[model samples]
Target: MSKVENSSAESGQVKVPESVVMTVKNFRSASDIDNFYRYINDNRLRREAKMILDTVVKAITPPKRRRRSKRVVH
Candidate 1:
């Protein structure tokens, strides 16, 4: 397995793996290519949106504190 560098943030471009590219190229119908691209884009968007929402929620939410019990000394 090759290490994939995430340069999407820096370049604003998605780096499709060579294998996926070749597979897509081998697809017979144009609709197949379109559907594949759409699926990829939708998944990427959903993941990114979820990450952003999680970050925002974490930032806005307060941290939980544990409650301490009081003990009586005789």
Candidate 2:
């Protein structure tokens, strides 16, 4: 039996949906154990925000200069 299967049986609740239970387990593993009980948590938006901030940082930083140069002289 799977983790969700065992949990559902112990809690006296109807068999939990596989996808929902997997999502719950993954979310719990990603966060600290102390707050893992917060079932409403979703990190997708938080990770997206971090990605946006990183992109903005890269945009604002100066680009590296190339050694190539073109000049004409007689």
Candidate 3:
């Protein structure tokens, strides 16, 4: 099994790795650092809101059933 599958099986929740890479030309001032902090905070809030919305959607929606294939006999 893959690492993701094993983790999901053990914890009942999947762990996905997320990242953001950016190159800053002049990242030397206090305001620049503050702006970066605010950006991170905003992203965190958005992610949390998305997770809550997804949970609510899942609770409201029904699970889909898989169709079974029938074998043909000659």
Candidate 4:
């Protein structure tokens, strides 16, 4: 079972559709996850998937930062 399995509708929470669950569990890349994210019809399920995707993206992508200029001290 993948991490996606943890977000199943069978858990007795908000019932996410099976198609959505299947899509997520079978995800092989970020684009697959994004497809499911767009496919979910339920608001609650969509939010849950969004949260997971956001976390996944954050974990995989490097953070961007602006470099500061160095100053000489007198």
Candidate 3 residue lDDT tens string, 1-74: 99879979899875655433234654534576778667768777767766877999999999899899999999
* Best-fitting candidate, scored by lDDT: 3
Superposed by TM-score, candidate 4 places the C-alpha of residue 12 at a distance from the truth, in angstroms, of: 50
| lDDT score for candidate 1 against the true structure | 0.72
Off by over 4 Å in 1: 1-44, 70-74
Q: Over all chains combined, what TM-score does candidate 3 have? A: 0.37
What digit string (tens of lDDT, one per residue) describes model 1 on residues 1-74?
Answer: 23344556466777877756655446755676678668768777767756877999999999999899999999
> Model 1, clash count?
0
Candidate 1 vs 3: which has more lDDT: 3
lDDT of each: 0.72, 0.68, 0.72, 0.70
Candidate 2 minimal-lDDT segment of 10 residues: 32-41
Give candidate 4 misplaced runs (Cα > 4 Å).
Answer: 1-39, 42-44, 65-69
TM-score (C-alpha, index-matched) for candidate 1: 0.34
Residue 13 error for model 2, in Å? 69
Supply candidate 4's per-residue lDDT for 52.
88
Q: Score candidate 2 by lDDT.
A: 0.68
- Highest TM-score model number: 4
Report model 4's TM-score to 2 decimal places: 0.38
